[model samples]
Target: MFVAAALALLATMILTIVRALSGPTLYDRLLAANSFGTKIVLFIAVYGFLAGRPDFLDIALVYTLINFVGTVAVLKFYEYDDSVGGDYQEDDY
Candidate 1:
């Protein structure tokens, strides 16, 4: 059962990669990348269980946190277009 789930996750990850590569917009690609990261976490957890290695869970948790932070940072960068100098200018909309 675990093996089957792992395989399914792998397939879904592949599809996510394809979507990330061929997405029509930046947001679509970002969504796909986030999904791919989630699938990777699931895959790692499942594989760890199947292989009887409990340490993998810790690694997966850490990876999940990193992925979340990275996604947020990228979104913030795109949204504000700000830099470390704090010279943010409002868009003239």
Candidate 2:
């Protein structure tokens, strides 16, 4: 059962990779990348369970946090056209 699930996840991951490569717009590509990261987390959890390694769950959790932060950062950067933060305007006294 776990083997079958892992295989399914692998297939989905492949599809996500294709979408990420051929997405029409930046948002589409970003969404695909986020989806791929989610699938990876699931795959890691399943594989860890199948392998009887409990530590993999912790790794997956960390990956999930990173994925969330990265997606938000990318979106923010695109939205504001700034990697650091909002536009900066020098004060005129």
User: Candidate 2's residue-wise lDDT over 1-93, tens digit each?
Assistant: 888999999999999999999986666688999999999999999999778885889999999999999999898887677444334334511
What tens-digit string does per-residue lDDT give for candidate 1 at 1-93?
999999999999989999999987676788999999999999999999889886879899998999999999888887776453243345523
After superposition of all CA atoms, the RMSD between model 1 and the true structure is: 5.3
Instruction: Kindly report which residue pairs in candidate 1 clash with one another.
Output: none
Off by over 4 Å in 2: 82-93
RMSD in angstroms, all models? 5.3, 7.5
* Residue 88, candidate 2: alpha-carbon lDDT: 35
Model 1 lDDT at residue 33: 93
- TM-score each candidate: 0.84, 0.84
> Would you list the clashing residue pairs of candidate 2?
none
How much lDDT does each candidate structure score?
A: 0.86, 0.86
Worst 10 residues of 2 by lDDT: 84-93
